[model samples]
Target: MKNSKVFLSLCAVLFILPSLDAQTKRIKRPKSRVGVGSVDRFVQESFDLYDKVYKYDGYAAAGTPLDDDDIDVLEEALEEMTVLSESAPDIIDDLDGVGVLKQGKATLQMNKAKKALKYSIKTAKELLLGQREREAQENEDDTAETESGDSPDISGTSGNQKDGADVEAEEEPSNISDKLEVYSKFDFVPGDKLLYFDDFSQDFIGDFPSKWNTNGTGEVVTVGSVEGKWFELKGGYGIQFLPLLSEALPEEYTIEFDLLAVVDTKTSSTARLNLTLADNNEFRDGPNKSSVELPLGQFGAFSIRVFNRINGGTVINSSLNANLRQAVLNKPHISVAVNKRRFRLWVNQKKYVDIPQFIAPDKALSHIKFNLLGMRDGVDRLFITNLKVAEGGVDLRRKLMAEGRISTNGILFDSGSANIQPRSLGIVRQISQVLMQDQSIKLNIIGHTDSDGPDEANLALSKARANAVKEALVTIYKISEERLTTEGKGESEPVGDNTTADGKAQNRRVEFVKI
Candidate 1:
């Protein structure tokens, strides 16, 4: 009887298994019918136009009337923006931006689109105004010609052409002569030491990344013409992904990553991406004790939402409104600087959000995750790479005194060149100020590079770079040349992994050692 009962139970399970499988099959997600080809073409065209306009030397083309090609480019961009903004049917001008939100709010994407449209409209108007002005001038000239029997040459401009050409030539140097000049205004500087860095280079393509934990699996996929592998999020329900870090983030650290939003014709109409940083290591454990949400979309406006149980149960919410369409279409670099409760974030090169008190005074982020929360089907693609976390908020003088050396990724250089970028002036000035205060102090300037290309070449480059720094210190800051010595480490020492971009960037650095 016992044997019979056991056999019967096994038979029942086997019999029900097929039905369960059938039910699962019935509930399986349907493949998207809209192809990626249309999306690809749109992306390509948008990028091409943006790149051309962004790199165009407006100074060089000064006083030149809008040509047919220029008008066509602007028109194409205008048409695309119209389609993109209008693709979603429930399009309401709710001054507050796009996507699912606690309240109607504008997003970076929405603002960016609106700004682009505004520019196009303005350009179109300007073009028309210029045409009208030119026509009127022509008519006046024609009347003058009819009366005076002399027509001003179209090729000549009452000596204005020579003046314009001279002005154009002068402006050209400001644009090309110093590529690093703009960087002087870019105040962001990397942290003192590397904490955690990953570019996903070690992870095999098409497989779930080995170093990340996801409630639902995510594959490491490569995009066309894009370098490195990125984790792609795909599932019906939301997925949470966190790096395999042993401990929580430090009190003062910086985090940066590149984000790419993939849009398809089906999904681009109403796409949304939600990311959150929480104290909980795993979301599957239970409800979040504390968390901060960043929802990006609704035409590219992004909001920061925070909820903490420990810190007075206070909820803080804010939004950074700007034009960020290009940031979505292309890869946008996200940089977050955290100094305990204070948080500052930058998208691309623009500082959109700055919160002196971002989190509770007692709490810090333990893990960061990606989610497709409340997102509609179709626009569910995102690519991430070059993640870097480093300790910041350092006291330079204290560190130098304690360690007898100070290394910085601050002193930057042009790629493959020994020329120090102007952006390094801030750090350079700081160092010079310190030296000037202490005339007895002597220092050694060292240069290092990542293991890229050939070792001999890197060694040569490093030496040249070190010497260049020594020269800059002497000439620019008036630092004593006798007090400074130069050396090159090449790839002999590395604080980070060479295989990853973040690691490579960390490795290529300069150091000041007290001698």
Candidate 2:
């Protein structure tokens, strides 16, 4: 009976294989753009293989025993995926050399496919091993029962043990400290003095933020699994969202924010979120402005545009094709640094745009304006939080060496938590560099917080945050733990008023003091 069931399953697989092959053949290849078409087809086929392997892994993990036939099919799929992943780099190189596709476009997809293949292979192997072990044990039990002329015990002790092991593995939490090594090359240093900071914690849910102005509708809302409140801006052609600033922006400053987009890629292909630095903080676009327009959801190929208009005339109109589709859908940190005519931008840890003469040095870029274009009214959504602006050009190393103490609000953390924000690593990196250069420097790290929560809880959070910073230095930067000590003053040490947003931003700072 088992043999007949296996034969039927194999026959069913054989019938489905032809249909899959036919579907692959139906994909039309562009004759005029052979290289581009080949890449697109390759990516599609790789994803299809990945989906199959993922499903097979799920079946195996759900305690469903994969028979020999099923194992054979999974092995074949894994081999094909492995070949595709191994050939990706060479394929990307050839296409890039031919100028058939934009640089990094194919490479991005290749990297993603390779990563997926790696995890899928690992999962499939573990599941297959478990299945084989169970099969071997069952055979042994059958042999014993036949030899002793007794019925075998079928209480499923082995199966329960396997399920319990899987449960334990699933319950293990991932360590963020282990992931910080990837940011060793990250060099985005935030400005020294924070001019403005807002995580939308001060605003009520479903209400417009008091410190912001917008022509279109927007509300502060909390997103699932994301920390703090976010301002969700409605989509339209001429809609504009502006933060109310007391004074015009300086020539040198940095801006950082967290962005999340939830939209159907097919429908939101043409949607764009524009970050504009203009002369005024109003709903209307200023005459002189420099804008960074990012596409919301184009999965295949997309471009980031930087447009500059000075003296009522457009000067800089540049675009670079980048693979930011996945990053946009996931929560991505956006960082921008402006120094005179030079402008630079980073999405997460990767720097996407850097122009030497992008901004107009003559005009005062006072306001940061946000505008959404080409999105559906109710279907698409965009949210942004932790919007921070700070003055640039402070040399942290020099300041620390000369003054013996340096205070900075740039080392940010999660709301009411000790988890350090990844972007805040830039500031910590600089401090690490200073320590590396001078091993004799023993310093004390102090954490402070705004008076929003209870004193006892705030104090504990502050101490935990200070300890987190110390751990990052020791673990990630390999700094000596003996050279560092941590303390938290909490709301006891107040550098700014607790009533105002800017004041709260100032008060919540980390200070490195030489001891």
Candidate 3:
């Protein structure tokens, strides 16, 4: 009788399995590739228009948008990006090739679609996990509830339960929820993208990641050749992970690279990797501070410092393993990760550091505090052959950094300073990059001077400096000065101090105050 009962249950499950399988056929999966004769033609036409739109050198073409139907023509083209952003990643390893700047609206639309896809994937994952947990709990509760009742003998009640076996079997597969999850197999946004950061590149973000600003303006970052590095110096951003990070990110993530310094410098003008997580605008409020320094080589080191509004400051209380202690000062394969709040640093694939947990940085859900920024100087060049950002890796600092949003403040030079050095020019271009990310922004350019510089001289100088930068924007950049303004604040306001040379330098600055 026992054997017969077992056989019946097995047969019941087998009979019901096929029906369960059919329910999962809800939405058709995206084809690995989508193309046809007419579809192919449409794609090509859209791409062709894309090329034309991106070439907008700060001005429109003669009688453009067909002289009348700007909205219709552009809207049609923008829609194509929905298909393109999804498929482009498959064809090209680097999403950068999509060239979102091909058109303003199109770029915004593409980002929206991609971001939506990511959220869907996340949701689906959560749903799927919740279902599994529910199923497990149901089973546990059923057993417990059953055990609590009077013990059933091998009699009529047990036979009744067996008769309804098929009903119970039917509920098993409903647990495979149709909802997408965070780790969606098809849609999770690839965290890595190789993007250009030089002045020549176009701004692509429609709704930029938070903490990304070009304010505190000094020099516009642009593409320039560096001796050691292959293509250029400050030419491209190594990895722009997020606009901001609000909390301790994934338990594991890493930013690893094999870099070679172009030249050596003693004044600690070393290339840096910034990990910032804060929303207070004040650097100290968050855990990721510039003060937390990571060392690299003796010639130079890969240092971890608290990086935010105030910039890099050595962490005094850090108890990082001495090996992973210093920043990659000169050049080496360095990896940074944050796991369980503890930061781990690695050099050349070797364990370098294990430091204390940092303060959680997310004050708001939408705001981001995590960031990873690389530094390069004109005097000394650094070649980064492979700079990869992998979320959830052995390196704790790198992990948190992947989610961290980068700030544009450090790109420029000291406050009250207006030299626009070659190094910081890339920064200026970077800021322009942030502005260009959202075309709707109107900017006011204000230049300040140290108190000692003679107010009149400083004011005149400030005005000239603003105009000089304006020329770069109007002429070199071709951005419409329609929304741009230049003002001079000649030492009337001091951000820092003017008594010391450093303070004086800090006081003289040109700002891109948001309008």
Candidate 4:
């Protein structure tokens, strides 16, 4: 009796401890030192279980009962997912460490784990109860001396069908079109000229990028699991980052970059991304604080602060709270258009701030610097990628005569085919408008390709692409085909190196020269 009681006590402890721990235990996430590897590992492990175990066939032949191993794996996956779900919210604050993309992915995976666990638990319980009920019914039928019927019992099957029907009845089709229609409000478009672009592909992983300079430490790391390469800012102590260039920034240029913020832990302290324009061609060190008066002859600045939690903080200065929310919650795509002294900033397709009087008297911005505000050590990281600085509001006449040709990346074609994407319509329309306004002008539409495949294939593709553009101009934009001629360069003249993606993007272009 004593031994049996002891065994029972042991079983109770084994069962109760897990539940207790789960209810009370808090995850100890690294404060200033979480790597992409940690996040990737957790996410990959969670997805592996989701794909291999949760998606695996757990049902038997008749009763559709799950084995002990299947139940255990499902339960394990759910438990692991629960930990991930709890921890993700904490780490997601640092845009560079764990951006909107990974956080969104974690949320989805957690939901899957929940659904799979619920189904498994419910199925197991039902199977056990069903077996007992069948046994009782069979005994009653035997006692009554009933003969076996030609047909099997349909009541059990009908009950399952009814349950399924109830579930189906509860669910409604998603209004996907309605959701998509909401995006009709999005009107953000890229600038016309591509002056300078960097995707961080030219930089080797784990090294500081060659094109950028910073006061504090940072490294170029690839989040290979999620598909991006970024320059991750090391937490603690504010840093100023400047992209190195020989030519001064254009007065009416646009700047764009992708940002991911990661919060080391939940904190009232906000994360800040400050972009300051400097008149001098020299590098300045330390925090790029806009509130503080700069040294003599320096340009102005714009700062954006993203709060950790919703309603956690207020927007200071001219920064938009909506943009702050976007920066904190999603991998924000930042767009800045500087039309001389006037400036406009858009975060994740929404216009955030527009300053008509951005530049001060007697000071024009020659360069720009990125500054990250410091939080707790090991708690915050800011990541930046796809930095593009382009001249906005094109001068068509200047581009044609001064440059001897009008080149554009605006005209695009479908992948692996000569078909045009709908988004290319805007550029095509602009070109058509230019042509229509100047009836005396004739154009030789030439196509160019990156050095990727065979020369012959590239030549064919480029020629086909050029022809397709001409056809689009004639059919859609109603341009005269007789006014246009076509040719292909086939990577013979590349503006950029073929080794990198950014370089390849530059190499693949379409030009219309005076005929």
Candidate 5:
């Protein structure tokens, strides 16, 4: 009895542990290179089972009573599954590390699965053809009897009825390969780089501006036969992004393009240099519509307005700095360049925006978008083509962490106070959302700052801010303290240059790191 009880206890632990671990495991999702994949397995199996009944005599002879309508539905599902399976790998791989591979031994099996589904659909069509023939023959027989004004006395097979059924069954080929082919091709992958609306599809109903909703003169314009317009970027209008593309854009990368524009104005509007990277809190979430416009000047490398200052986040309207950028407006060539944060814009082969030891482009903006605000007033027209991308350089998140720049979880304070700000409410709200999704994971909110003030002052202030953030989340957000912790780092850590305005802004910020 003792041994039996021990065995039972062992079994109970084994049964409960795996489920408990799964609940606690943090999910890190890698980006999928390809979109669609093979169809769901159960769905494919259902198709195959029903399809065989329609094609081969073997299934018919087994005495199953499934109808033709059911057969039709199954065959259609099979076709769709084949397409999906071809695009998405995980749907069929059912294995760890399978989704990331380009091609492998497992991929071969997936190919077979796809082929089998295709054949299954083909078979079902053939069976449907046979059923239609049977119906036709019965009609023919009844018509003959009615016309003769007599009923047959004997029940016997007729040559005419058999001939009719054969003709009807011959109508559709169960072998899809010999009957028809399905294919998908694209001339252009249309849509904006930063923000995409629901209408980023071929359907007419989804192509509405209200859904994408841009502020200012930025209309959704269509230039020539280039087709549908999702975002029509107007000159001097800056667009703020909602935290898309992971956190920030990648650094040490080549951002090549496929853009279309018209530079018809001599106001240097034609030579608009588009700006893609901007870092500020005003553009983080709802900054009441901000913009950082790029003025692509005519014939000069990306340095004509090298020394200009108009500091409003991003906007449609430009102040004195708008004219300072010197847009030549009517240039007709799409440009490409490699940019470093400090290096700025390099146009037509020259180191422009030549600030020293600059910050690289924001890693949060790892997207395929262009900046077109600067030069193109009326004469500027650009047609974008051939999008190409490659990345290198230090990983932003890792670098920031190495230098104690950004923490995964951090406290936010109200501006200008060591005491926790009321606005840390936003950060608390987001943390609450994360906790709501994950029940087992724990969080730590550590605070840090730039070295503008004394070390003791900064450290104490950081602690106050951190504690305030903790209290608000626990008391107001109602998060359990068992899963929370807070700490403070004074002026000892710095993520950006303490000398520049942008760097100081980054330095004097909260950092959150997962423990």
Candidate 6:
């Protein structure tokens, strides 16, 4: 009777498996607001479920009997697999109208989840059968021992050896050093001097940042699963947010910030975030201005539009589809460099725009403005942080050759971490060029830290960061490791005030000295 029951249960599960596949094929694609975040969350959840099931399968395959709790968990996982498999098709279809970048990611995630679910079902069934067989064998042994007048063996061993069951090994997490290799061709060198820097750390939550002014409402808020404070900008037709600069932007400067957009299918097709350098700091656009506009919606190609005006007359206006829809969904670093009339922009490591005449030569761009267009008031939003504007055009090689040393705050890292920011490679790249040009030049790379943490921890972090820079030069730029030495000064050397934001920004620097 027990065998019959187990057989019936297995038969029922096998029957449902085919039906589930058929249902997925027949179901119509529903209009959903499923964003990249939603798809990522579902994939993570499915993987978690798969992990639980796989562990139980491993134990069962190792000739271990399943405990009551293990069986219950496996039963729950089976139900979860059913639900996840049913939902995957719809979640994948959400990427239909999005750019290939987003589609490719979603498709890969969904396929992985599908395979995990399939293997989970197979393991679950085999586990059930093995448990039933073990129980039956134990009962038969008990009857034989009773008839032979001998005691039953109490050893915790099972003869059932699962054949050909291979568990997949977990992949190792990737390191930042390995990730830096992709930025070998990255040529974005940030400005040498820091003019304006804000990470919103000093601001109170729900309050607008002190250093910025906006025609529309915005407040600093922390996002779920994302680090640091983000200034969330509310969208409207002509909303403009400006950072209050003490002086007009110089002829050579660079601007950088981290951008994240919370969007869905309902996000307007026309919604975009515009970065503008205008003549005036007012809420309106000035006569002389240059703007880079990026679409913030999920349903369109990742495209950028640039507009230039000189003396209240439009001079240059154009747009390009960058095929970066998926990248925009993830938090991306935005870098912009202006050397007199030359304008360049990079999203992370990839340079998207470089124009010789994008900015008018005679016009002075004094103010930086952020504008949001066609986004819903509450449903769609944009968040930005770590805004850094610096004066560029410094000849690092000449300065190093003349002064025998060069120090720069441009080589940034994650908060208290040695992991080099990919954008920071521009400065390091310049150092590598210098090294390549002069093979006999040996140098000492020293790392510094702001006085924010324990002295010992800061010292360790500084050392790790210097070593990371050395690794980048050797691995990415193919510089000789023998010529490069590293040191860490921690917070002992004070070039700037630790008490102020600008001072801290100045203090957290990397120095290359001739040896």
Report the number of the highest-lDDT candidate: 6
Which residue segments of model 2 deviate by more than 4 Å?
1-176
Q: What are the runs in model 4 whose C-alpha is more than 4 Å off?
A: 1-195, 263-269, 281-317, 321-330, 361-363, 374-376, 395-405, 409-429, 432-445, 460-488, 496-505, 513-515
Consecutive 10-residue window with the lowest summed lDDT within model 1: 21-30
Model 1 / residue 170 / CA error / Å: 15
Instruction: Give per-residue CA lDDT, model 1, range 366-404, as digits (tens).
Output: 666666654555545677876777777345666776688
The lDDT for every candidate, in the order shown, is 0.55, 0.71, 0.36, 0.53, 0.38, 0.74
Q: TM-score of every model?
A: 0.56, 0.67, 0.25, 0.50, 0.25, 0.68
Candidate 1 regions exceeding 4 Å error are 1-177, 264-272, 284-312, 374-380, 395-404, 409-444, 464-486, 495-506
lDDT of 1: 0.55
> How far out, in Å, is residue 171 in model 2?
10
Error of 3 at 395 (Å): 25
lDDT tens digits, residue span 1-515, model 4? 63354344334334422321110001111122223454445444444443433232222212345566754554445455445545544433332313333433433333333333333333223332332122333333222221222122211111112221211111222222211221223333346667777778778999999888877788998764545689886645556677886578776776777776665335333445667666543544322112211010001222343211112222234433331542453566666767766666665434556666555323345677766654445655667887877676444545665565777764545555665543344455566667887887788888989898999988988988888778767765678889999998888989888997667777878888887
lDDT of prediction 3: 0.36
- What is the descending TM-score order? 6, 2, 1, 4, 3, 5
lDDT of 6 by residue, 223-312 (tens): 997999999998776788999887789999999998888888677767888899888999877679999987777776757898899888
Better of 3 and 6 by TM-score: 6
158-205: candidate 3 lDDT, tens digit per residue: 111232231121211211111111001211111122111111112232
TM-score winner between 2 and 3, please give it: 2
How does candidate 5 fare on TM-score? 0.25
Better of 2 and 4 by lDDT: 2
For model 3, how big is the CA root-mean-square deviation? 26.5
Give the clash count for each candidate: 16, 0, 98, 14, 75, 0
> Which stretches of candidate 5 lie above 4 Å from their native place?
1-213, 217-222, 225-230, 236-243, 268-271, 274-276, 280-303, 306-356, 360-390, 393-515
